[model samples]
Target: MGLGAGPPAVKRRSFTRASVAVAVAVGLVLAGACGGGGGDGDGDGDGDGSLSVGVLLPGGGASRFGQFDGPLIEKQLKRLCPDCPAPTIAATSDPAVQRQQLESMITRRVDVLVLAAVDPQLLRPSVEAAHRAGIPVVAYDRLAQGPISGYVTFDGTTVGRLQGEALLKAMGTKARGGQIVMMNGATTDPNAGWFKRGALSVLQGKVKIGKSYDTVGWRPENAFVNMTRAIAALGAGDIDGVLAANDSLAGAVVAALNAAEVRPLPPITGQDADLAGVRRIVRGDQYMTVYKPFEPAATAAAKMAVALGRGRTVGSIATGTVDSATTKNIPAVLLPSVPVTVGNIKGTLVKDGMYTIDQICTPALRSACAKAGLTR
Candidate 1:
């Protein structure tokens, strides 16, 4: 945070999300569906006054949830359903644990489920089980398969394009002859494919990829090991840039570069404007990160869940639609992302209150921050 700026404002009852929920409930009820509160708290069948929402998050590999997703989601849920019993959220970092958690939520019979699956396709059967039980599922973030009613996510293709463009810009004169190592996300998560395809579309023919590896679970450690291997295979100096899929991978890649004793690390790209990524940007450890404003994505998910819970149409909420493997015409809200570098750190993340200069530029990084003109 900034020197005098206090902790970020993250509160449970601070958001304004109930109008859409209430209105949807009222509308559906008038239209002959016994909408709003199924006694299970989905507000789907009858206005029973309680909602049990199980939020099955994917992992702890990234800090997005601990920092932003959890509180924002909780706050939105509570604001949307004030008098209803507080919504229940079962959060776990492990996929196997998440599977058990999913079964538990199924056993508990949560009214509505918002999940960001670790393995989207692997969770299909579990999602189908909830569907079998007539529970409405809102596929959050990862877009788990099966009979999902709604979806919310940032545009992966757009994110990849941003990464590619930034990598090229960072490479400067080396852009054409640049030999970048691709540290991509797992093949299991379909979004990884989406991101990779977008990056390849922009990067192909323009740059030569020396070596690439899919880091399972988007693990920083895995990326670190892979980066080490890449360095050994293709001399550290030959690699020009790194197309790290997200911030965590970029962290691993940078650490590997330091270990290899590469004087000035090549320009590396990442997604998720993680604090670590931001700090890396300020310190020039990493080149750029895709700053996806999670609030808008969270807001869209909140609206979709509330609407689906209330049995209302999503016409007002849907920004556009997307197609999944099994489901087509899936009503979705895709938010755009931006590229953040040292040049615009203050204007981008600082101005948006995502991070503060103080939180970023510690005594160790003060000089670098000044060099980047991040200090006022």
Candidate 2:
């Protein structure tokens, strides 16, 4: 779950013009079904001496799922296998829908599958089916519960530890005995439990947990509703801080606090350097967010998928191994996550090109941007 000390910092690399062009072309081919399915029947092969990759993301609305992961993976795949048919991508929040999509890809007899399971356990049967069909599955972001050949994701427990440590720092003196609310991700996502465990490891003796809730579907509305309940039960003034699992939930928690008219909002922790989350940090609404460089993770997954499809070993690409509920010693590339506060906006997001000053510092955010030293 936790990768102990953070991984050595990776030097960010820029894509060449030719690779960018190919990525754009691949993007066009997979346009329509950004949150659904694409490609034709029985993808056994692209019929052009090329392999077909099936990518199933766990729905949109999280920002990263569609905006970052999907496109990044597409680009990396194209760059790696120029002749391969553009990957078939599908996105859904429902496990049943994901299962059906997986089955459809299996029926198409795709060469390989890159899946970010909606519910790891519920999708086991589909993964098994893919395995039986001789299609290697690369579990993306979340570890799926079947015979996955490889995994690509940030260290889950480390993500939690970063959030917890940031929360403690933001809370300052109050952290010694402050009562905080934990707004964790969906129970169906194994990463959610791992995150909670890591956070508890750092927070248990340091602070009192006033309330904790596992959001359903990792939906912001669900988080909003849960935050409202926590406020009602604990009283707004009694809560010291909020430990939100990700940026979406952080937004929901912030909204609930605003709705309750809780003055001088408490420090809130989040993961995923989402634009809104970064904006929140600039405005002093959110204390910090974890930034997991997605390009490298996407590149690793793309390489693994393509290699597996070609019957090549992935030992060189995998940095480590992880155990799923039903599988053990699965090869994995566990990337490190960086803690991004207002102080390091330039070093993290801006430096990595995840966001430019112009993008982050809109007309409305110019003042905050300037104050945060984001002037360009």
Candidate 3:
């Protein structure tokens, strides 16, 4: 997660001060290259028998990026290619930083890149550069622009629809022409648009959208500010439910509702079955969160990266193809997602081994967990 330690140091060049400085400087460059570099490949274009995978994750506050996707992808890659070098994994919320990281990976000549772009449009040039360098890019989790060879992610529309349907269920009678707020993810992410489209398909004509905001950076603070403003505009009593883009935004929305002293908080929908989100559901704060199983998607991405690195076709592994803003008919594997409520925590997260009962039912949550029938 921390990109491991820097590569080992090189020996001193000479006793002279200048030589020593040169050696140290050269050592740092070598360290960076080694840390980020992929395995060597022959001109045959199939990379050497040993493949190096460069994985770029879009930040880590979501929990899944560091806790599940990173480790699971590494494990699957090892299973598929024992001799493959450990993936050069990097993550940052800043779009510029992510772009620089992608360029570094491309310069290192990594056979393949697995990228979850922080900003799809901003990363297009770098993705194009990778393509020019003959490195296949596999867009992971989020579909990126520019000549991507493959993609692996859950059905974005389905995820949003599930969240919308669950919010309606939680709202019950109020769902009949109720007033709801929409907290969408960053506009930079293509999936945000897909999710909004899908949620609109279910929520339109059925509910009054009192307020909607496109959160920047997908940051909780941004969501909090938006939610607080929404609360001010709509007043507590007028709001019936909230359509939160993900668990992080959901948390922020809940915080704002609490700050406004709204008693008996309205139903809130979220995606990414983050632990905090799950606990919030048990405590009756959040209505539900969509669980997009990470293992299968991670496995598929790893296998695709490996296959692409080996100059092999991903058709065998990709279940379908997707078109991006800049690319068409790109091979893809779109997994399914499940809406998780307090009642199905055990049947979903627990059963999937994403969490243990003890992990969810902490001492503080014992009573809540018991009431939710999550004990033992």
lDDT for each residue of candidate 2 in 1-376, tens digit (9 for 90 to 100): 2221122222222222122224333333322111111222112222334679999999765578888999989987776666777999999988999999999999999999999989887888899999999999999998888898988887777788889999999999999999999999887887888788878889999999999998998999999999999999999899999999999999999999999999999999998899999999999999999887777778778877877877766665566677666777787776667788999999778977889998888788889999999987
Q: In candidate 3, what are the lDDT values of residues 1-376, reduced to their tens digit?
A: 0101111111111222122223233223212111112332112223236888899998764467988888888887776666677999998989999999999999899989999999887899999999999999999988888999988887777778888888888889988899999999888887887788779889998999999998998999999999999999999889999999999999999999999999999999998889999999999999999888777777778767876777767664555677666677788776667788999889878876889999888888999999999988
Clashing pairs in 3: 41-48
* Deviation from native of the Cα of residue 145 in model 2, angstroms: 0.6
Against the true structure, candidate 3 has what lDDT?
Answer: 0.80
User: Which predicted model would earn the best lDDT?
Assistant: 2
| TM-scores for the candidates | 0.85, 0.87, 0.87
lDDT of 1: 0.74
Clash pairs (backbone) in predicted model 1: 36-43, 37-43, 41-50, 41-51
Worst 10 residues of 1 by lDDT: 1-10
Task: Give the lDDT of residue 359 in candidate 1.
Answer: 85
Worst 10 residues of 3 by lDDT: 1-10
Compose the digit string of candidate 1's lDDT tens values, residues 233-318: 99978999999999989999999999999978899998888988888888788999988766656655665666666656654455
- The segments of candidate 2 whose C-alpha lies over 4 angstroms from its true place after superposition are 1-49
